[model samples]
Target: MKDRFDYGQNPEKTKGGELIAAYLCDPETADAEFLLSKAKYKAITGREQKKNADILCYQIRQSFLPGEITPEDANRIGYEMGMRWTKGKYAFFVATHIDRHHIHNHIYYNSTALDCTRKFRDFIGSARAVRHLSDRICLENGLSYIAHPKLHSKGKFKHYGEWQDDNRPPTFQERLKAQIDSCLAEKPQSMAAFLQAMVSAGYEVKHGRGGVISFRAEGQKRFTRLRSSTLGKGYGQEDIQAVVEGRAASSEGRGAPPRKVNLIIDIQSRMKAGKGPAYERWAKIFNLKQMAATLQYLQESGLLEYEQLEKRATGAADRFHVLSGQIKSIEGAMSVNAELKAAIMDYAKTRPAFKGYEAAKYSKKYLAEHEAEIALYRAAQATFRHVLSGAKLPKMDALKAEYQKLAAEKRAAYRDYRAVRKDMQEVVTAKANIDHLFGLTDTQKNKEQER
Candidate 1:
């Protein structure tokens, strides 16, 4: 079992509703968002009517041993755990999500108490307390709990889905680590040789006053100390020195042995077109290797039949289309919001100038001097007034703040959109490659038609 907390809500952020939607998305599950409300305002609308936006909600998650508990049981356990932990002080909602590899619980609680007077005390070490409370709950429910000693200190905290879907570029350190491992595999004769090899690999090497070496990988802004703890023990100065002296061979002792990947390319078969006798033999070998790789991929994925491959590929494509549509929708909304905010700001800024222009009775000299400003004011005034539509316009600062909030939401939405986009691209690429291997591409169809 594991627990994580998203502590202390930011005033600008509005993730409460999104969190609710995410955890309650599984249609098959009952009692999703099982609210344990203590406040007089039970419904979300009533809760929002309080008008206290700061610290809208507190979100936390508890993940269980996969395949151990059913969704129904998990929901009950999560509800019980949430209520007990909150001590009936804060109104909370428990949502058990069974859509991924792990059955997890998402708990969101109103920061304000039932009386709507006092707020939840979010002090230092509150996260640990929540985990401890969860462990007790798990143990009481006959579920295994992760003990303190078994927990990892420095580790990824993302849920399985989030981690699998993350598609950000590799960090500089990751690239550098791969380079170092590859260089070490070649068995460099000395530290100097290693440094030279690093430079050749497109990294800038700098020696400090105390014999410490730092490396700056290509496109990296800062030099990283080669002895930093983030690189682990074996990649440090002492470890490299040991390797240079032939005391250590590779990074294998520091971690698991590297797994080799076999490539799939059929160069030898192509060479067998009889262009040249000697080259044909080599080409045959290359073609055999490529076919071997493709076959291996199919075997691993259990894609034994053409129909299976086709279905998988088309499914991936369909998902890509859906995700593309979602991205476009979000982008469109963001653009409209931005344009509206800009128009409002422009109208407000040019109000005084417009008044002066009106008082001057649309003088040609004044119009020429501030044509753009006057036109913007005239164009936006009606739109802005129409937006207000019989209601008094809010303060300029308030409008700007609302725009900022919308902008933040758009940014968060884009982050998710980008992750989905990356996933779509990967699946689409895999599908195309599979189709090509099977001679199912449009080009192949054209060739068959020609034949």
Candidate 2:
């Protein structure tokens, strides 16, 4: 950024190529013109070709060293990258050894196409691929490469308000859950102990409409947990006691039931893989041990009532495991096909024979045959990719529209199940609270035993 300079929208140094070649030798006029024409400048910058040409000249020296490279070494590296990356159907420019700060090259390749089509437009993820290419080039030469800024920020996920880059306020549920979690985390225990801990943490609890509960800290309503929704995972003593007993308790007593427990874990495995980029959305969704634990928790707590009644929901979850395997296979095949296509197309681009059958390179027929193979391979690869993408799923035009429909139905089912469990737990928490905290009378005990 610091080194790059502008020469307006057009270049005044018409012999910019000669300037580049000057590092190796005093380039002849004919050779300079040939270099400029080879740059394919018009194809790359489109209407702004000359502007790009000037910038390339300005930046080329920073890319490599002029005094260090031998003439043959410069030619070889230039020829090699040209062969390795060029798309056979695109116009590309290449120049080297300019007597500037360094003996580097500039390539003004037609970012659009040589197939005389805009097929590359909106094509895959190639738009931001230059960073990968630049790093790869430095790596190939055993040189240090600069890291892209966005790539470094990719994994910084946090739930804190100050952590958010966007200024939007957190959803009420999110704020409430954070507060509840903070209070309960003072100490960890079964449902009763957690409620007792919340009380000790100086939270004043009160009931809200629709069976919800609010906890205020320092006279400020900082948290609220819903009683019956499959929302945040906090529960009040009443909410916990009501679950195991199969009904909300008439009064706090000593007839509480046992608490339900669940486990969560993240697991990973490795595979022998090749050089292509693999798509793995399914991998995050499918972990056998975690899924098994979740399933057992749901069953022991009676969370999936409809699935338990018909025995279909657990089976559907099992099918997701199978789907994960299929996705892995699809990604592997796509990787192989795409990599092969790039390698072959690049070879043809710099091979001279494909450039209208120059004798120094392969024959035009040879390049034609490779293109035919790429077409066939691309077709087959796409079919497999579509199949593994779960063809049975309905197409989603809007992210929220799809999430809303899926999450709503799933949450409704989960809510019914969690509510039943919560009712039972509330009975346990209430009974425990009375007996332990307030102490029970003989008559109250007799009544609890009578039930």
Candidate 3:
């Protein structure tokens, strides 16, 4: 809680916390006050407060497009959103941070009620409700909200950076469709001629059993069936045959955009896979073209020397591992924190039932009455005993703080993770291409000797 509030209240980010506005709590003392409410709840109910009992507070981040709203206005809007959402039943503070190009608010509200008797229960569709509220508040303050939100099929929302990467390299199926379209454009007179055109364009065509046609692109392990089921409508084998026989118009203007660089082919590996002289020739030419592209990529990246390229590839790979390790470590801590929190909450909720059963002198009737609760209580106790192992159970505030800190670190690391992963892929691909071009592998060297 302190970490979150402090980050937002960074002197550099929020102009020494001047942009902070609080209701029913001081910004500096909010964390303490929030913790006190939890304490009060425990005292009032005689139920132990567990690290994972109910949420101590909820945070909502409201961000404005660069230069869209002033820091003060952003804070006010955030404050309004919190007040309206909680209906002033909970205490909250809004801290507007202007550290990035976007001005965003960190609104933290205590989950425990002002009276400390009940917690603000999060309901289904709370996210949507808050979004709607935020949008309404934004409009009332003369700010814009997302008028049309795009839905992801997987139910995971994409961040701006992820959306920016949508224009990536086409998939294998898309490339094949494009290739088939290119073959059709040649106006082949027969299916045989169309297959020949595909071969000329570096595809290996196979006439399978039952007249099934398939094509394998360079570096592809499996042949893709030329069927409507696989390639979608209008690009099937029958569709191509129809176009070839002039029975139907060709599917026009479909192909992958030219790629900036292509990976080098493993010619020796292809030959060992029973490729003929024709395939060997095509493979050599493909390798040469791709090697040139790789060289250009290296030159542009300032890795002209083979040693420099190797060093870069190794460094990129190492850096990727380090970032991955950091993320994994953070995730591991988070998992433990979450598990402990849930266990604590379970223990606290079932403690009363277990106590009542004990008071009944271990009677089977009482046990039968509260079997589920008593069992859950025992399980939680066992978990604490196993995990803590005589160590003191950390305070709920400390655990929350640790989890928040870890979460922040994870987010920061993930941003670097994406960039480092991209760098590693490019540098590693460049190195592999260089190795293939020079026939650095033993198999390639043997092929060279045989020739």
Task: List the candidate numbers ranked by lDDT, top first.
Answer: 3, 1, 2
User: Which runs in model 3 stand beyond 4 Å of their true positions?
Assistant: 153-155, 159-172, 178-189, 195-451
Error of 1 at 440 (Å): 3.9
Could you report the Cα RMSD, in angstroms, for every candidate shown? 27.8, 19.3, 24.4
Better of 1 and 3 by TM-score: 3
The better-scoring model by TM-score among 2 and 3 is 3
Checking candidate 3 for backbone clashes, the offending pairs are 52-341, 178-255
Candidate 3 lDDT, 27-57, residue by residue in tens: 8888899999888778755665678755778
Tens-place lDDT per residue, model 2, 250-277, is 2122332322221111122222332212
Clash totals, every prediction: 9, 26, 2
lDDT of 2 at 165: 26
Score candidate 2 by lDDT: 0.41
Worst 10 residues of 3 by lDDT: 253-262
Q: What is the lDDT of residue 158 in candidate 3?
A: 76
Candidate 2, superposed: residue stretches over 4 Å from native = 1-84, 87-108, 111-132, 141-194, 201-212, 216-221, 225-238, 244-451
> Candidate 1: which stretches are off by over 4 Å?
1-290, 365-372, 379-451
